[model samples]
Target: MDDFRLFTSIRYDPELLKVPSLGFTNVGWNSKSSPFHMLDFHRDRMLRAAIYWDWTAAIASISGQEGLENLERFLQGATKDLVNGPHRLMITLARDGSLGYEISSLPATHLNNLYPEYLPNQSFDSDSNISVTVRGGKVPIKDPMYDIFVDSQRTTKSEFTHYKTTFRDMYNDARNRAKVNPGDKKEVLLLNEDGYIMEGSISTPYFWRNGKWVTPPVPRKFDAFQGSGGNDGTTRRWALERHLAAEETVLADSLVDGEECWISNGLRGFICGKVKLH
Candidate 1:
């Protein structure tokens, strides 16, 4: 089968300046079943996510003085070509005032790597096949660090936590480390400066404690703890709105205290696993 394909506005055009824009929407096959809840919140979510990329020029150009209208027009056109599938669609605005978008699909095998059984509104549940490891080494500037004060106060001056920029070297490192020494893992959970469980490098980490599903609290600049960091993902929102999950502070060593563990992202939705700290 095809390794999935991409339909991006930048593919054909070579002179685009590549200005950063925030917005991505992914849907499962059949176009109607969006397992990650994209159907209900993708548009709004994209707008909210755009806050992370709110550059001065981008904001000034699109803010007051009829600029917002033009920006909306660009957003509508950029996201218009998206359709349902096991795919990811992203729209980015160029610094040179160009719109770029990409729609990418994944094959069944790639899908199986994250979820053994492909189904909408379903999570990966495997025996020993799925494993997780806490991130080690120094935290990068782009990645979030835990702040106990941030958790208590609920401040919102978060910079990198809410955007999906391409700064993923730290996450990539954790994933690579998990693959070492026999290799029985697929996800890398992270911890904050104070050594508390924060989130997955690329996904939201959750645990099954007592009789309820709980996830790490969202991090703010001076709130208290390091959050799952990223926009409010559709899966996380779905779990919360449906009462499938709750938010609470979690410690790194406390990971073993849970009866079950899981990580979620737009692409994987939710992938259940067992923790193996490193």
Candidate 2:
């Protein structure tokens, strides 16, 4: 596996930083949600970002150097390092939809085990917190589809959602659980809420047949049910054009038959290494 070299930054759980000795909270999320859902709460216009799903990154360098710091300082240092081109930030959200102050180090897998945990989170408490050994290995983004993917979405979202929204309590619990079960296991397959074959630990769901990048219909779990803005959309507005494949089809009814199933997401952007699912 190759390390996806992108500009990187770090954020932290301010609470953890206040107590500097304990390990820091390392996380991130795809925070984008409709603000109108809380129209009543915003009469004063006091607002914060609300995301659908939030996850963790990692905490380490390949050389065993712990780079734990408050996010403001981390971002400043990352900018100073000058390697920060396209960056990923590690963060934690509090229960109230606020951010924590412990940004993680590089090599995201250390945060939540990119492979398994990111898809299906785990559960842990003060009793659990296994000592993480095995210093490091940074796997560069394997799919060239990512850098292009994250940026390709120039389409306007119907509503406003600030996912990767503020760090919250649910987010904190999930992050802690990931420690007990690091998702780096290569063989693990990511499933949806129903346990159906959905996607990989990071990749989105897509299948190739006749040389096309066709993905499953965006599931209803994340759909916006009210007026206007909803989850009915694409990771990339021009998903078909960017992948250089043609003929878009939706598997919302069912998975694409016999085509090549590849997972597409921020981490493992696109993966075609599928063996068999049924």
Q: In terms of TM-score, which candidate is strongest?
A: 1
lDDT of 2 at 1: 12
Instruction: Please write out the lDDT profile of model 1 over residues 24-135, one tens digit for every residue.
Output: 1122221232222233343334334344444444344444437545644554464455453444445454333344556555322122222222111113322233332213
Q: Tens digits of per-residue lDDT for model 2 on 1-278?
A: 12111111132222212222323222112111210111111111111222222212221111112322233343455345434222334333333433323332333222222211111101211122333331332111222111111111122222221122232233233324333134332222233333233222233445444434554333223343321121222232224423423334432234422323444333323233333323
lDDT of 2: 0.28
TM-score of each: 0.54, 0.34
Instruction: At residue 126, give the lDDT of candidate 2.
Output: 18
State each model's C-alpha RMSD to the native.
13.2, 17.5
Q: Which stretches of model 1 miss by more than 4 angstroms?
A: 1-40, 56-85, 93-99, 107-158, 180-185, 219-231, 257-259
Scored against the true structure, residue 102 in model 2 reaches a CA lDDT of 33
